[model samples]
Target: MARMIPDNEAKEILVLYYSQHGATRQMAQLIARGVEQAGLTARLRTVPPVSATCEATAPAIPDSGAPYATHADLEECIGIAVGSPTRFGNMTAAMKYFWDGTSPLWMKHALAGKPAALFTSTGTLHGGQEATLLTMMVPLLHHGMVLVGLPYSEPELTSTQSGGTPYGASHHAGVAGELPISEHERKLCIALGKRLALTARRLNA
Candidate 1:
């Protein structure tokens, strides 16, 4: 049976991502903070690592931190914020694999009309952060979610030297995660989350 999210309960926002070196994870948390700031519940979830040689199974539950995202998480959330580190100007294979498995939900229109946003981190200044963010949106678009992006009106979009784009929020992690997220990048992430949550609430109403 398909799980149902109760109308009476507070709207839930799912912050899902696959972080290789923790920078993406930090971005997810920052986004979650913004979701909470908008008075919505944020459920943080992560995807398991994928194997290249053969099909591998992760334990039913993760060893620590957020549980691996189940299809139910996508169905239960009124909004979604997805993040990943750039892999040759695209989302990592692990993250892409997770989305590829969501065809069932896509067919069911489970996420239709929900508010969604994307984020990404890159190793260098020109390391395809925007392309990565844009590519990540493809699957979400197929699922019928509304794409929310940072608008040029956000002052940081104009002032940001490290990472900020109209496509979505982003961070330049530098080589080996040496660089911290800039003030502009952090604020933009929070803003994206808040915008998604607020949009979800308004849509639900």
Candidate 2:
């Protein structure tokens, strides 16, 4: 465990993400497991995909994986782990759309002082993993959440040749997004999640 689990532990860390090819979604699942490893509950959630046609709509509930997140999830979670598939050196439009609807929480400072972490998956090794992660942090910063990231102290950070960064966890999903996460990349994802959850526990304790 990253830290001693409080006897009265009640708060959870929200593991929210948008995935196109299931790679980012897998990362979110691993992150949530890591959060639970650190003794805090993890709330797995997802955002629906967007469409070019304004008239198109997503179902009220997702068909599989996790349920769609609500503003209440943001308000209730002690911390958050956000993930997205990189899109042209930035976050996906679906993920952005989710944040765009969070103005009400922003106004209430609902996420202020909470800890947040980021994760991303890209089709190639040089597909803007860092840029996507950095840009993803912008809105969380506006919400006044503390940012958490993997440090070099994590052995995988120094040894991993595939995907890992101080900015956040990352995965190389191949051009077709068919690659499974590498061993080192998986460890880093879990590490980042534990780090974020530990921070949340400390602050909330």
Predicted model with the maximum lDDT: 2
Question: lDDT of each structure?
Answer: 0.89, 0.89
- Which segments of model 1 are wrong by more than 4 Å? 1-7, 54-58
Candidate 1 Cα lDDT to native:
0.89
Cα misplacement distance, residue 171 of candidate 2 (Å): 0.0
The residue ranges of model 2 lying beyond 4 angstroms of the native Cα positions read 1-9, 53-56
TM accuracy, model 1 = 0.94
Against the hidden reference, what TM-scores do the models get?
Answer: 0.94, 0.94
State residue 18's C-alpha deviation in candidate 2, in Å.
Answer: 0.6
State the lDDT of candidate 2 residue by residue for 1-205, as single tens digits.
1233355757799999998889999999889889999998999999888886532257989777899999988887888999999998889888888898999988877788889999999998999999999999999999898899999999999998878999999999999988899999999999988999999988877
> What tens-digit string does per-residue lDDT give for candidate 1 at 1-205?
2234477876789999988889999999999999999999999999988778434457768888888998988988888999999999999888888898898888888888888999999999999998898888889888888899988888999999999889989999999998999999999999998988898888887
- Any idea what lDDT model 2 has? 0.89
